[model samples]
Target: MSINRSVENMAKGGMSMEEFKAWVRENIDADEDGKITKDELADIIRRNGEWFAGWKARKWMRSADSNRNGVVDEIEIGNLAEFVQKHFGIKIIS
Candidate 1:
């Protein structure tokens, strides 16, 4: 789906936390590497029309990359929902 459409879905509270995570994996993982990188995270934030996307992405990476692997994998992805909701203003229904 287009980033705009994904953003619209999120803004409409049409996704649960699990669905949001899947959305990020599907739509935001630019490289399709099964992991979310800092750049990808920043891009998603920017797509959402947020200011300081880069900085916010960095903060989120720090908070969510539990192993400090420099990327968020499936295990770490769950940590991002709260940050996404809080920082990106994306509503997570569950």
Candidate 2:
């Protein structure tokens, strides 16, 4: 699927950033750091299959990582939520 379609699917599927953060905390944050490492993020994308391709994953990390930090924290996740809301017109209450 195209990037737009992937985003649309995420919105349509009702996967809010808060929910995603929980998922990350439960599944990706194995180190218990409250932040998702790049490797963990990439692994999640890979496990999810083609929708979260390498390029898209990198793009998302770059876009969401506002502080340019290596990991994605709560603030960056909020930014991602905003991006989804703005781009897909989905209101995610957080």
Report, for every candidate in turn, its global Cα lDDT versus the true structure.
Answer: 0.77, 0.64
Clashes of 2: 0
C-alpha displacement of 26 in model 1, angstroms? 2.8
User: In model 1, which runs have C-alpha deviations exceeding 4 angstroms?
Assistant: 1-5, 11-14, 88-94
Global local distance difference test of model 1: 0.77
- Displacement of the residue 39 alpha carbon in candidate 2, Å: 1.8
Q: What lDDT score goes with residue 8 in model 2?
A: 48
User: Residue 49 error for model 2, in Å?
Assistant: 1.7
- Tens-place lDDT per residue, model 1, 1-94, is 1234556665674577677766776778999888889999889878878788889789889988999989998887778776666656667787
At residue 61, what lDDT does model 2 achieve? 73
TM-score of each: 0.71, 0.62
TM-score of 1: 0.71
Model 2 alpha-carbon drift over 4 Å, by segment: 1-18, 84-91
- Backbone clashes in model 2, listed as residue pairs: none
- Cα lDDT of model 2 by residue, 23-71, tens digit: 5577567788888666775665566565656666676677678888877
